[model samples]
Target: MTMNERIVQPQALLSLIALRDRALQAESLNALAFSMANDLYPVLHFHQALVFAQRGEALELLCVSGLSKPSEDSPYLVWLRRASRWVASQLPDQQPHWLARDAVEPPAEIAEGWAEWWPAGLWCVPLQRHDGQRLGLLLFLLEQPPAEGLQQALSGLWQTWAYCWAALTRQRRLRRWWPSRRQALLALAVAGALLLIPVRQTALAPAEIVSHQAQIISSPIDGVVERMQVRPNQPVEAGTPLFSLNETTLRSRAEVLSKEVAVADAELMAASQRAFDNPQSKGELTLLNGRALQRRAELAAVEAQLKRTQVLSPRAGVAVFSDPNDWLGKPVVTGERILLVADPAQPVMLIQLPVADAIALEPGAAVTLFLTAYPLQPLKGEILETSYQAKASDDGVVAYRLLASVEGKPEHARLGLHGTAKLYGERVLLGYYLLRRPLAALRAWTGW
Candidate 1:
């Protein structure tokens, strides 16, 4: 007898007993399949083994012995794949296949490659449940076909292994995919309610404190600012001097007009006396009177202009200007803005909404502002007005201007104090509220 044949008699019986024990104790499908393949090594005289699992009407190679990943174009893989497909397509009445190199006719290229890499014969066993439902395929390589006695001994063992593998794999799949009935119902209920919930949509913009009703103080005539009577942000009463223009030129003209008025008065008196003494001089006196009146009117106009050179606050408020030096030496024209006399008690919000970040704004929309200086203390306000056209902001960005009135302004609130403002809009779904910007960006990208 051959040395291998003598050894297989006792080894085959021992391996069969070991396979039954290991299969019952295995925890996972991988462990069980790997153990079953290992236990059959001695009895089947196989060098390599592969396990494939059925997935959606096709077989997926799950585990391999002696390799990390198989190459797609390998000769042994190509032959094994064909054999697996043939077994998968078989009728229940057909038995499992034991293929030899000469029995199967494949492409010449595959045959040539296969001869160099693998043995001449292959054993393919179909894994199926007790009800005859196909699970997958088991593949092994051998030098030659097994003896009839050995095949008879392994036939029943193969059926038992298939049944165990199918049951373990199915149990694991069911546990992974199926949750408890209570958990499923709760998840569905939460999803339905979340889809129906409504939330307020908000847009953010930069804002600054501004006066609601501020009187703008400007120069009435063209002149250089000579002196400042009040400092920037200083409180002032009505008729208070904010800053005075260079009155040197205007005063000089007034002096000239005064001297001309005196000369006209003296001439007018002399002309009147002449009229009283002689009737011929009476016509001359009328002309002299006209000249005197014209000079007097010119003097009055000059005096009025002279008075306007001293700029004054029209109402009691705080002066708002950048710096005293900004206006002290600056030349101004008629009606050029110099400063703002704002009522400190009536500060409002001026928001600069960038064109890209702007949304639909309406009067009475709620707004919350968090100042950079005092981020923890938020100021509440409501939108009062919004500009239809965009204007250049102080920072050189094109933005829409919005006016808002504070609800309860603090005593420390001052004009030009900047903060971030959040404006609330119409209610919408929570999903829409969060995804509004992303959806807008997607639309812009797709141009739809």
Candidate 2:
């Protein structure tokens, strides 16, 4: 049917007005075109809708509706692909126009395919803003010519819908792109102010409860452990037997030395009598006296070794050691460390600050210890002393040793209790406090 043969009804404007409202409310250009397609379904009698957005010199497909998705190699899809670029260039005047298969010519490459599968008619509406800027194109493909009333209704609202679509496109572009200069400057100012806020600089390290004046129990003489008198963590008094070394060899050596001392005394006494009888024997008596004195000194040394056989606690405290079986059969050399008998009354926090995380620590610096057993109740303390050099800790981590004395003596505080310590240093900006390590790492990586 020809365009002149069709007639438009006067009441069709009401339906067109309702459709325009729906299109205006859409969030994006794609949604507006999709909604328009659905609203015009009964009116225009179209089978498929295609929406495209203009990008530089090309028209990019944004949305498609009404028809089932065609296969990649379908003849209809092949025709559409071949014709999209030609259709984009045809709408140069930013006006809505209809194309008839009889009037428009197809490209030579897909001419046969278009003739076989293409729709009978296509209406192209250029989406243009109020300022006449062409945003994109919307196409409705029909199997046959639409009624005159539907055609006139679509023509009347097409420009209004274009303006709505153009507005939607502008809103979307603004959201997707970067912020304006003013917005960026405002954000940077807020961040700078936050970074300038002062905060306490703190360093975290692994810590444990240790004795301030722990008495070390060492082996005075080399001997095998015969027995352990005190259990680990057991309370003990001064002079309490901690562990005993084998005394059998020491007692025998002392007895032999005693016998030699008696023999030397008898020889010296006989020599003295002879010296009195004869003046020539006086030199022999002096030599005998010297020998006796040497023997007596040897006996005293042996006796001293016998006395050290029984290891005793030097001060009254808790016996801090591992398993009792560990010390039972252990042989130790002279001056070898046996165990520690820590005075529970004087407890200090021993911090193991890892070498990688070490910070400048001074005496009396604030320290907060959070014991594993008593995690909620943090104990307050201050740095007492720090080792001059780093040493290997129990867990094989190279750490600096730091001693801190807790302020209040809590009843639950016990020696050997493990905890974490947060040592506070000088105040610094919040940015430095948070990014201190990251900055250090970046500097090391860049070497500047």
lDDT of each: 0.80, 0.80
Q: Give per-residue CA lDDT, model 1, range 1-448, as digits (tens).
A: 7534754577557777777777777777777667755667766768677778877777877666665566877766867676556545643442456777888775676577558766887777777777877776777778877666667667777777777787788787787777679999999999878967898878889999989989898889889999989988899999998888888887888899888888988987887787777988888877888888998898898889888887788999999888887777888899999889999899899999998787777999999988888888888889999999999998999999999998875965678899999988888898776677899999999999
After superposition, the stretches of candidate 1 with alpha carbons farther than 4 Å from their true spots are 1-197, 273-281, 430-448
RMSD of 1: 9.4
Q: For model 1, give the 10-residue run with minimal summed lDDT.
A: 86-95
User: In order, what is each prediction's RMSD in angstroms?
Assistant: 9.4, 8.0
lDDT of 1 at 332: 85
lDDT (Cα, tens digit) per residue for candidate 2, span 1-448:
5433333444455666888788778876667766766677656667777877777777766666763333556666656765777877665587667787777776786566656655777788787677877777778887666555556656768877777877777787778778889999999999999999998888889999989989888898889999989888999999898888998888888889889989999998987888887988888887888889999999898888888888888889889888878878788899898789888889899999998887677999999999999999899988889998999998999999999998888976788788889989888899988888898999999999
Any idea what lDDT model 2 has? 0.80
